[model samples]
Target: MRSGYSELLGSMRPTSTNAVVAGEADPSEVIEVSVILRRANPIDVSRRRSVLTREQLTERHGAQDNDVQAVSAFAASNSLSVVKVSQGTRTIRLSGTVGQFANAFDTTIVNLDEQGAVSRALSGPIFIPEALNGVVVAVLGLDTRRVARSHVQLVQSQNVLSSFYATQIRDLYHFPPDLRGDRQTIAILEFGGGYQSADFATYFHQEGLGAQPSVEWVSVDGNMNVPGSVDDTEVALDVEVAGSVAPLADIVVYFAPWSELGWIHAISMAVMESPVLPTVVSVSWGWPETLWGDMAISAIDAALADAVALGITVCISSGDWGSNDGTSGQTTEYPASSPHALACGGTVLQSDGVNILDEVGWPGSGGGISAMFPPPPWQNFGYSGRAVPDVAANAVHYKIHFDGADAVVNGTSAVAPLYAGLIALCAESMLGSHGAGFLNFTIYEDFSAQSTFRDITAGSNGGYSAQPGYDLVTGWGSPNGAALLDVLETLSFAQVQLQLS
Candidate 1:
């Protein structure tokens, strides 16, 4: 009988159709690859509280020693040097010549140029020893095309969105003054881009944040923050938004190279049970699951699951191109598609000179059924496949300080940090010394109770229309801070489980 690998191999196009980088993957040339192994068993993070104690979170999951040894031994046998292993994320980094990779995996590697970008990818079937079938799940960095893109977009119209400020929005949502994310740590992920201290300073000074909230830069894969640059508008928006909303929370921005390798590493870094663990993680970059191969998807989804199990709140942007996901049409993006992440959507919100007037799902907000993921049981009432966005925030226009001046920005990119800030505040209220688990559990528990939702009844994102209750366009509607906190204050995971049971 043919192995399951046969099907995945069949899906890739042959090397003949793609362009090759000059002298790439030559017998003498060396390359780096990541080997991701499967967990021995599934982890259970469902708990009586929202987030768990660090000790409880760490004890729940990790790579089995046997799996790690098998992968390390495989690398040694193949003449690949073992660089590093993250037991927390179940990943091993290896470096070897192209010839060794080709011989070990039974596939030739090729470089391809498409659009304006060039990438390295495998030309044929990626085979592994039959013994490693269940132990090893994926081999990444074989195709650099799996890199992710930032989801932020710039609004063409000026001044329309400048009137809105993060603090004001927080007030509009009725975020309790006592729960302003004090001492909470929020981690933001970036594939490639950086933020400037000066820009952050400008934003905070204007916002009158007596003293700036502390911010730290954590580099992954050796990519450091590129401060004061004209590029990377996405990074700037994230910093400004998070700073404005959760001014008291410490910000940890994870920067990495612009490939799938970097993306996974960045995510793993945020969720790792470090001395300073983050209460919430914000991801503003992603592409549809269709673009990410099974190897990449499996690894990413697994990492996200680990984060969720650890009681870390993972907030991801649901893309900016409406239902199309910037492709043919009606597709969804991942990390957002992963069951563990709280996928945030976008809305065109109107603020009366002082307060919010009307809010509708942004025409460009990404929301639809996932092509690769089955919708989580909590969301089965609305759709079959996993939905793009579980919640939404204003992405139409926002006042942001980037490249010196205050300009208007848009995209669901703004929504993740928006949700992250709220989570930090909520986590501060609930977890205290502990960290957070998935916020979606609480969100879905109250789906019927209807605490803290605006119920957007108008607007549409191409194929789907926003309706009463849960709809693809604006999942569970926008946040109503007071009602949400009220629901959160009295609820516990134990209570939710009891109610469900």
Candidate 2:
């Protein structure tokens, strides 16, 4: 208990020393906590061997029904009520008093004096019984109000980036307009945002992308689209960009409750879902890897590994805040830092509105060595640990049709769906129904050799500079439709050769 407390103390960031008591912790104040349990199938082994069927993956990986009983027993032992048990999510919800929870988890309940707002959090180690220790991966809901930032931005300066829309940028980067991502679906994750169908209609019609695109909205963890000024802008941008780039592909917007679990839930749901299996999943959200506890990181990465196995490409925005990633100091962003996912970075494209001029890495593009994960086998850049942003795209001053009008936006957030659309196009044109299975292996080891990516040989993202090949800032640079297709052809041939050998 003492050792665990010491470890937790290190994790907690020190707040203002002045502790003005917002309220006394009533010993009997009821609170709810969610406990995430470990899944049976290990993600590392199952990935890329073969994309598992939905039934195969679920039966082998889903939380066993009996596991819920164990958590119920634990709650009973602690004199707490088992409010809910989710078989698929592998999370058990427990409700108890402040004192009961404090005693049960060996932690203290405290009300934080966070300026004008008051919030609750556990002050000590959240310890589970030895019987449940291995099964319980994480304890959430300790703090009811600490929110992670959404990586969305309205273009702050037109001079810095030269306002460009999705159509112009895609053309400049050599994306074929004819492909239109037919026979593919893109899953866009949104945590706290709502989308209006009228807005989508207006945006698409204005962009000349056509009307009545196939779009589906999914609610996860009881979080749904709540239309707000800030929230609508991000969600709207994602839908608009994906639609403009891949007009024929169906779009699925999975909305979830806020925080780490909300983000993870959306990713896992996208992978495991059937009948609407997306070839590409775009996530325009993330926080510093450290902000997500070890358990949260591990669980999320495990789900992403399954995504790799399922032939569903998950593309996450590296972030818009460069090396520091919008934090107080330099830190690597999550989801992007996860080895199984592709980190999409940002660039400033120079063009004469209709033709390409020059492209440079945006200083706000998030790229750095990850402190959380070791370099994956595919990474061969002499990077000691995982390096972010496998590819780059123009983000600065993107004139996107959002909330019914053309609005200029900037952020790696816009970059994610752009890449997702490309993946969808590649899947339809090259791989057929099988899709591009776990792109990194082919990306780094083989396709990269065929001049698959436009190597950005100049500019920097603060800590790292764009050089000839695979530097931290612009990664292997932006997409070239012809070269990307060439890569697909090359990989397909290599697969045939391997089979024959």
Candidate 3:
């Protein structure tokens, strides 16, 4: 073990396999890092029904003043400048030169180039002084390598066999009528690419959605919506699918860089910082658990758990790389692997224009047991590790418009927004006083909610096969929206009665 430090802050190796040592980082170059601090009070997700407001959370669970002071003192002693401190997310920002940061953290800074893209990386674990050992959770932005990948696959123009409009899928799923997600907000996180307003207008107009959903943009860490990039398809797919399904719900797209820091920043903005907090948050970008640092995974998972405690439902795509998640063994993806998140898988739909014919687990749907997290209280499948996905939807052959051109898209990325819109719709009616905090608990625990899914018992995604009850390939299968709404309404009534009693 390395000496001279009170504690080691986990490993900080590069995630990319293609990364190669380019050179030493410039010592004089200045950079800003986000230091995540531990919460004053631990969050209890079981009590998610008791939703807390931003103010309430700040008062109860925000960073302790002493911790912030300790971090500030440490920064001052190390010649680092304090940028900004957020008590809500417990993130402290500090700026310093590469050499200064290296000396402060007790690590070497080196440049790594993966293919043509370059980024700085840490050679080993991060170290902290004894005074700040438990106060600091993670120090992000030191190694700015690309972290997650967008799980979007586009079908070629000529190879497209069939496509369904987003609204059609909603209809086929039997979504409750007359609930247009009014007063509900859906937050979508984008690491890169952007959407064009014209495409939204044209696509909605073509879908016969009477009015386009109100769309907004929030930039985090200097990242903005820049069109024409490779990720445009992922961005456009999420917006169009979610917007078309919940035409009146406000959709806020948060653009951040593709790093662990950016991921946390975007999530914090949606869960803790947004002026209009979202009812549901959708994530279409992530990688397998093996690709992420253990502490980094814990940090993101903590934020997701906070979202649950705040009554915000989070939906994450399990990934598009099948049960192995692009790795050699059967593994699950992070964020999805986080038990607090509703992990969404993929399915192939074979339907007539008006009625459903059949749906099966997509060959590329990501699923299986998580290597990191233990099964949550809601899960009772006799598995030691958390099982994914919690639910699934059609991910093949989506009719979408992006960059002023209509295209066919496929992947589990589309499933996240689809569920986000559906949750928004459900939130409008079922959420009288309490938010739809964690649907997985009810779905897995209640018989009525469990009956709402059209169980998919066919097909496989490598190591796992779809079965009647719940399977690794497709979880509980696709939703019967109206049925689910009815179940939620009943549960809401029961909850209200319990409160009065």
Give the top-scoring candidate (TM-score).
3
By lDDT, rank the candidates, best first: 3, 1, 2
Clashes of 3: 0
How many pairs collide in each candidate, listed in order?
4, 0, 0
- In candidate 2, list every pair of residues with a backbone clash: none
- Deviation in angstroms for 411 in model 3? 0.6
Tens-digit per-residue lDDT, 332-421, candidate 1:
888787888898998887876567789999988888898787767666575668876788988866767876677777788988998898
- Model 2 misplaced regions, further than 4 Å: 1-32, 45-47, 64-67, 79-89, 93-103, 113-118, 145-147, 156-162, 273-275, 430-433, 447-450
Model 3 deviation from the true structure expressed as Cα RMSD, one decimal place: 1.4
In terms of lDDT, model 2 sits at: 0.75
Write one digit per residue (lDDT tens) for candidate 3, span 434-477. Answer: 55667887888898898889899998999999999999989999
Clashes of 1: 4
In model 1, where do residues sit more than 4 Å from their true spots? 1-24, 44-60, 156-162, 228-231, 432-436, 447-449, 493-501
Which digits, one per residue and each the tens of the lDDT, describe model 2 over residues 1-501?
734332322223334444444654667888777777777665563224766766676667766666777878878888999987765556677999888877777777678776765766556557767666567777776654344556778655535445765767778777765678887889988877787787888776776666345888988777777776677778887888887788888999998866655666677678765467788999888877666667567767777876877777789889888888867767888888888888999887787867668888988898899988888878877877898888888877766555566677778888899888888877877754376766666677775632767778888877778888787887778888656866776777777689789
TM-score of each: 0.91, 0.88, 0.97
Superior candidate under TM-score, 1 versus 2: 1
Question: What Cα-based lDDT does every candidate model obtain?
Answer: 0.75, 0.75, 0.88
Of 2 and 3, the candidate ahead on TM-score is 3
